[model samples]
Target: MMDILIHWIREVDTDIRLGRPPLAGEARSESLAVPMMLQCVTHELLTLDPSLGARYRDIQEWSVQKALSHVQVRRMH
Candidate 1:
């Protein structure tokens, strides 16, 4: 199920990038929540079984990068 969800996430991202209308409950624009949730799922999987870390390493890294892309410089008032 995780593999299917991961694949679907990429598909939704592509659809948004290509300007296609989002289906029900799908994001219409880039969202920080997407990668954040993916990262959380990856973390939980690794926590459940450390041995799975190797398999999810790439996914973990990709999620981290995607989350980081949402960061922006902030100015103090």
Candidate 2:
């Protein structure tokens, strides 16, 4: 759930960045991975249909506490 939520966040951010108006092919091409990864995770997680709600619930909790995770990640890496 943590991983998928992180990827979901990346996809949203990437889409906002890459989906800007009037961009050229090269620029749009550079940031393709995030959305693509989002697709993959969406497929993977949704495959477990019934359990996804619980997983997503946890992700929501994590999102609400993201500042703590960001600090931890920055400190570690």
Candidate 3:
């Protein structure tokens, strides 16, 4: 599952780099993958130490926000 997530992430990143919006199917998959990825990360962090979950969730949230901002900036150009 991690491998598949990574592959999708990379595919999306590549499309962004090339200044192309993802195809409809890819965009749908990405919408699904992001939340699933966050859940997986949260679960793993909880397994390691329950106290880490909130902090890690915040970090993931920030990371996603930053990525979106970057994409928006790219689109402006």
Best model per lDDT: 1
lDDT by residue (tens digit), candidate 3, 28-61: 2224345445556757767989887655665467
Q: What C-alpha lDDT values do all the predictions have?
A: 0.76, 0.50, 0.53
What are the TM-scores, per candidate, against the unseen true structure? 0.72, 0.31, 0.33
Pairs of residues at least 3 apart in sequence or in different chains that clash in candidate 2 = none
Q: Which stretches of candidate 2 lie over 4 Å from their true place?
A: 2-30, 50-77
Off by over 4 Å in 1: 15-20, 23-28, 74-77
* Worst 10-residue lDDT window, candidate 1: 12-21
The local distance difference test score of model 3 is 0.53
Per the 3 Å backbone cut-off, how many clashing residue pairs does candidate 2 have? Answer: 0
TM-score of 3: 0.33
Error of 1 at 5 (Å): 0.6
* Per-prediction tally of clashes: 0, 0, 0
- Candidate 2 vs candidate 3, lDDT winner: 3
Worst 10 residues of 3 by lDDT: 27-36
